[model samples]
Structures are given as structure tokens and as C-alpha cells.
Target: MNESNLGRREVLDEVELKKLNNIRQKKLNQMDSFEELSYEQIMKMANMHNEILNNIHMSRGDVYLYSENEKLELVEDLYNTYMSDFRDITLKQVVDFSKNVAGVEKSQDLLIYDWEKMYIDQANQILFDSSDIGDLNMSLDKLVGDVKSDNRKMFKTPILLYIETLKESSFYWASVEEGGSGLGFSLLKKRSPYFMSNKKGKKNWKNVAIADAQGMTTGMLGVAAYGAWGVMFGPAGFALTGGAFVWVAVESAMASALFG
Candidate 1:
């Protein structure tokens, strides 16, 4: 292995390299699924408006008829679903650029697997008794159908659609009180490779890290912008922020798409 001024390379044993290779292969498979699945298909599976709204409520810890444990579990399930989709969408793009555009294989992969069906099942089971959150079950069932169906072709490359899902899913993940902070940070760090590898994204991941940190600052500012209005104007401010869960997601989604 050779080291460059860009970053030091650590030599890995054959076993380590093989494990990493396997992980990258899995990412390729997930990416294949992501490309086949269209934005319209995902939308048809679930109502984005409601998903956004419900996520806001979940973030505020205001979900009804569910215990803290259940809320945590449900939100985790949703988070995994979004991340699975994200890895397929984002990492796939990175890998493709490496192989096709750059004539190189970056050899990147995520520890996550595409368990879309498992996520749907867990969500349904968690919300089985409640009618309110259960409304989301329709979307979940739709997603299950999309996952199970052999024919999935909604659009060629609806880049923004997956971004929307990623943002919304992260919102839900950040809603849970237990591991919200950790999950959010993990997501941002793990996803840095997309920017590091893609032509549109940052070439230097260190810069991506800096941008992500700054994004957190701006994200808080976005929260304050909405929060300040809510403090003075009441319902109208709440309307803009959508009940406390609308912090910086729009920016994050835009940033992800542009950087990816």
C-alpha cells in the first residue's frame, strides 16, 4: 500500500480486504435496486405529505397511543428504511462514478443491508393497534408491494425522490429521543463518501466533514427561524416548521443531491 499527502493509507490483511470487497458488492446490488425503483413508485407507496407531518409529530415526541419504547422502535424502523434506500441511491451513484466515469472502483460499501420488507413489517406491527399512526400503514404496505414486486420502474433517475426519502427518514430517526443524536451524526459521517467519490460532490471528504458541521449550524439556524416566528405569531410559525420536525431538512436534501 502507498500513502499520499491526501491521506495516509493503512495496509489491510487479505481477510480485511475480502470483507470490504463483499460489502462493496452488496452496495452494488442495493444500487441496482435503487435505480430500478422510481421516485413515482415510492410516492405511490406512501403519501409524502403525511409522512412528513407524522415525522414532525414523532420528533416532537407527541405521537399518541404509543409508549416511548414503541415510538423508538417504530422510528428506528423508519430510519433503517430510509438509510437502506439512501445507500442504494447515494452509494450506488458513488460506485457508478468510480467504475464508469472515473474508470476506477472506489471499493466503498455500507454495513447496512436492504431489508425493506423487514422494515415495513416492523412498522406495521408497531403501529398495529393505533389508528392514527396506523394510517401510515397504507404507505408501508405500498412500500412492501414495491419491494416484493418483480417489475419496478417508476422513473429512470429521479435523483430528488430518493433525497426526499432520505431527508424524511432522517427526520423520523432524529425524532426518537433515545438515539436521535447518535443516529444523525452517524448518518452524516457514513454518507460523506458519496460526496468524496462523486464528481459533483466534494473530492476531499475532510471538506465534506467541514460542510456537514457547518450544515448543523445552519440547520439550527433554520430551526430558530421557524421557532422565532412560532414564539411571536403562534400557529402560523408552527405551520412553517410543521410542528417542530421541519428543521433544515430541505437544505439537507438539497445539499445531498447537489453534493452527491
Candidate 2:
């Protein structure tokens, strides 16, 4: 071959080699992630996931026969168990779980928040309207319907809000459970999906957390003052409960100041 032709051939070979290397690197990363997860870790994730799923189903009725305090501990234990095992969850793992274990077409089915969208939207609207307590409870009951519904998208905002709320006040669930406030515990658990997504490393963790916090706090005080917490937990009930529930009281006071 002429010198010019030889040089062109070398350039083409180099480009092809680079592409092959990139593909190999991707496969290596995938294999490493798979091998990094132990059988115990996989079982742990699956067990916790199943617990959450059962909780969602139980939330539909009075099947949870334990005292409010017991329920609180149950939820906290579940959170700790899941968080302790938090690792980068891959799409392949989720798919495998869905197909092999859940017998569902999509992993999203297993990830659903178990609540209805219309109820959440309506309850949120009423919370900001200074509505009567009866109305708020009624709306909540409607939102947490019997059958498991698939609305993971609708839960994103609520999960983010709950995370921001929890990050600011670590003992929120404990306080609610101590105070025997079933409504509060149920509300706190709504943030489960955010943690699930975090485990999977779906987005920039810092960015997702900050955005969730900002979104939850933004204009929250103004709307909260309209008797949202009060309606949900009863007049002065949330304020009386100390510890993590303090987040609610603080926000409620700020909201009261803003909208009053």
C-alpha cells in the first residue's frame, strides 16, 4: 500500500479499537455490579420490598391490629433495614425481580405507592383551603383505597416532600407513633419511593435531595397555615407531640404566620 493509504488504514483501526474498548468496559461494569451484590443482600432487598408491599396493602383497611406505637416501630424497622442495605440498584435487577418473583410485566408495578392520584390531589387542595377536619379525613380515606393501584409518578412529589420533612426532623415517625397518631404514620410512609430510587442511584443524589427539600418547603408554610396539619392530626394535637413531629409544628407556625 502507498504511505497515505497505510496511514488512513491505521486511523480506521484505531477508531474501531476504541469503540470495542468502550463496549467491553460497559460489560465489565455491569458484571462487577452484579457480582458485588451478595445473596444475602439480594434477599434483604427482596424481603424489605415485600414488607413495604404488605404495608401498602394493609393501609387499605384496619388489618394492622397493633397499637399505634407498635406500628411506628414496625415502620421504623423497615426503613432502617432497607436503608442499611442501600446499594446501587440496577434496572436489570429490578426487571429480574419483576419477571421472576413478582410475575408482573413491569417493575413499576412492584414500585407503586398504593394510593390514588385523585385523592392525593384533592386532599392537598383541601388541606390548603382551610377545610373542615371531617373533610380532610374523608379525602384521605378515599385516597388510600383498597386495591393496589399503579401510580408511581404521582408519588414522586409526596415522597420528595416526606424526605425533606424527615431530613429536617429525624424522629417524625417515632413521635407520631408515640402520640398514637395513625394518620401521621401513614403520611410519613408515603416517602418510601424516594428511598427506593436513591438505592438504585437513578439520579444525582445531592441534586434530588436538594430539589425535594426546596419543593417541599417552597410555599408550604403558606398552605400549611390553612389548617392542614390541624385537620389531619386534630386541633393542637400535632403541636402537643414533640420530637420529630416538631417539623410539622414548626412548619404549621410559619404557615400560620405567613397566611394569617
Candidate 3:
């Protein structure tokens, strides 16, 4: 080609370079705007509540049954006492009572997954615009974490608590068989306070279990909040220190509401 033609081609190449740069800059600006949106706070609160439910179920057995026909009429009075004396207490109160009754001196240990590590790794990938494969894997990891955490903390122990409450009530009384195939029912005589005391101990254990589950579920909320923010704003926004600070604040609020 002639020198003039070569010079024209070079100029056109420079114009294309400028256009590419402008496009890149525009995309970066859009990303920045997207990152500014925040909503992790709400998700954090939900997760905390889930934790409380899980803890309660873990500590308490599934159910308590009483049958006069089965020579277990004592359970009837216990159920009545629980209903009448303890029904109005909060979950925390119930848990505290159980702990005292059981003489439980230490907190139960719990196993927790490191969801923040996974989230951080994913955030790095999202910021870099890495392969879609990588993003998908990270998303999957987060979702699995959320599901497992939630399942671990649901209200699985309330039925048992309800049964125990009934067993502690005074309404359940013993009965005696009389003449003409008649059965005379009456309360047990010489009731022991130790029996009542032991019942309280069992209730305490159930309460601790509930508390632990609550804590775990609350932690999950933190994970979920981070995930939601990362997904909605893209990794870059979530990676920002400001985003993390906001997440922490939200998490703290949720924990307080659910477990404090």
C-alpha cells in the first residue's frame, strides 16, 4: 500500500482504541452504581430467627405422653402444673428454668461452617469478571450454606415442650377403682418435691438446646445477608469495606433481636 493509505489505516486504528477505552470506562461506572445498592440488613434478621428455633428443638425431645390407662396418671398432674405455672414464660425463661432444673453448668458446643470464607472467595471472582463457571460455583456454595443452616435451626422441639408443659400441670390426677365397676379418680397423695425439681431440670436442657439453635440460625443470617448483597450488587460492591460494615451492622441488629 502507498504511504498515504498506510497513514489513514493507522488513524482509524487509533479511533477504534479510543472507542474501546470509552466503553470500558462506561461499564466500570455502571458497576460502581450497581454496587451502591444495599439490602443485606433484612436478610440478616431472618437468619437470626431461624437459629433460635433450631436451638430449641435440638435440646428438647420430640414429645412427652401421659396415659392414665398405662398407669402414668402422674404425668397428668405434671402437665397441669407446667401449663398453669410456666405457660406464660418466654422461650428464654423456659430455657433458663430448664437449665436450673437440670443443673447444667456449661453451654453446649455447636458446629458452624465458614460461610464468610466462601463469600469472600466468590466476591473476588465477581470483581474480576471471572469465568461464568466460577460465579456459578460460588453461587451454589452460598445457597447450600443457607439451606443447611436454615434446616439446622427450625422449630423441631416445640412439640416436646408442649407435652412437658402439659405433664407438669396439676389437672392430671390419679384415680381409684370403686364398687360396681366404678373408677374413682383422685390426685396422688404424698407428692414429692424432688419429682417437681427433676422435671424442671429436664426443661432447662431443652431451653439450652433452643438457645444454641437460635445462635446458629442467627449466624446463618449473616451469611445470607452477605450472599444477597453480593448477588444483587455484584461482587465489587460487596467487596467494598463499606458494604462489609453495613453487613456487620445489620447482622448485629439481627442477633440482638433474635438472641440478646
Q: Which candidate number would show the highest TM-score if scored against the true structure?
A: 1
Q: How close is candidate 2 to the true structure, as a TM-score?
A: 0.19
Model 2: residue 140 alpha-carbon error in angstroms: 2.0
lDDT of 2 by residue, 1-260 (tens): 01111000111234543453355345434432211223233223223322343344444332224443443343344334343443243223322221121111111222223443343334344333423334433544444342124443332323223232323221112223233223323433343445434433212222222222222332121122121111222222111222222222222212111111
Worst 10 residues of 1 by lDDT: 102-111
Error of 3 at 78 (Å): 41
CA deviation > 4 Å runs, candidate 1: 1-23, 26-35, 45-60, 63-160, 166-260
Residue-by-residue lDDT tens digits, candidate 3, 58-128: 33311122122321222222223333543432333322222221221111111123433333333333323
Which prediction has more favorable lDDT, 2 or 3? 2
Clashes of each: 0, 1, 35
Q: What's the TM-score of every candidate structure?
A: 0.22, 0.19, 0.17
The sequence of per-residue lDDT tens digits that candidate 1 reaches over residues 160-212 is 22223423333333313322223333333355566424542212322332232
In candidate 3, stretches whose alpha carbon ends up further than 4 angstroms from where it belongs are 1-198, 226-260
